[model samples]
Target: MSWKLQSVYMGMTDVATHNVLLLLKSVMRQCANIELNEGGNLLQHSLWVAYQAQAAGCESPLVVAALFHDIGHCLCAGDPELPDYYRDREHAALAATWLSRWFPASVCAPVAMHIDAKRYLATVDPAYRMQLGRGSKQSLENQGGLMTEHELSAFSSHRQHEQALLVRVFDDAPYVGECLPPYTRYERIVRSVMR
Candidate 1:
């Protein structure tokens, strides 16, 4: 069965473990409803980050952040029937702020800074700036994504910032077919983090 936050929240884990995966799974389900480009699902995005994290030798907190970074977008993409601009300014901050109430600093810190991680790469990594989708680039220039130097500096110091950076990076990677990686991956991550 598809995982739900409420189920895991009431499961055997303590508050800390429950909250992290609960929040992640909630976002995962929300994102699952979104098309990852044309015919893709957001669950693949989460799995991709988890696989990428392990390949890069990352540990628990960063790995966890990688798995849940874009969760905010799924949670707060706003009503589909509403106008595009009829939404919050920063999904990252919204996710982070909500996460801050329960997760460890290592996890929430990167969730909070994931947007800036994108901004910093855009500024410092010319190739990265070039690779952004038209909408993402537009968001960077016109929306609040372009980080001030101070914000960039502050974000650079956070733990697992690199992993968050990877999340931001892979988020734009070619959309694998919807459910390409299957539900099992998401299930494992959710179960693992919760336990």
Candidate 2:
């Protein structure tokens, strides 16, 4: 199915929250079969990340960013034109572009920078690169391996750099079999912060 995000968000001034939630629920349900690392399926990983964000005492926007950070994977999976590696290299941009319509830069900026955050961490923390999952390791190669000193310096200057790094921590953590609340647990939190 062609997912027209604009159509989904159109003409609802005050109800962007509800509409965005519905859009997220629809995507999650439709993409339930897609695996996201050994951590689990897409929904499971998102929930775990979001749970970690909340547990870390993140504000609502950061929690939402964690929940939706990898949504571009699902979007790319549905597209026949995009290659697999494109999903890895471009998913963050895809998700951030779509989410920018409804969320402030505080939320979307970190989502956009998540892939770079991984690369940054890999460069700064040698052990971080070793701990990556098979998929992430492969994607790291596609995402330009480790960041160069110049790239690292530029990425560090972004206002949301710290938030992006925090999200990256949750992204790399193994969530499967760990105790995490159900996806439903964050519905209210997501709704409250939407738009």
Winning candidate number (lDDT): 2
Q: What TM-score, over all chains together, does every model reach?
A: 0.70, 0.87
For all predictions, the C-alpha RMSD in Å is: 6.8, 6.4
Candidate 1 Cα errors over 4 Å, as ranges:
1-27, 78-89, 175-195
lDDT of 2 by residue, 1-195 (tens): 345766565636447567777888888675577875573688788888888899889999999999889888887787788887888899999999988887788789989999999999999998988888787799999988998889999999988999999999998887557687777777887777766
Candidate 2 clash pair list: none
User: Which numbered prediction scores highest in TM-score against the true structure?
Assistant: 2
Position 100, candidate 1: lDDT:
64
lDDT of each: 0.65, 0.84
At residue 122, candidate 2 shows an lDDT of 91
lDDT of prediction 2? 0.84
How well does candidate 1 match the true structure in TM-score terms? 0.70
Looking at candidate 2, the ten consecutive residues that score lowest on lDDT are 5-14
Give candidate 1's error at residue 57 in angstroms.
Answer: 2.3
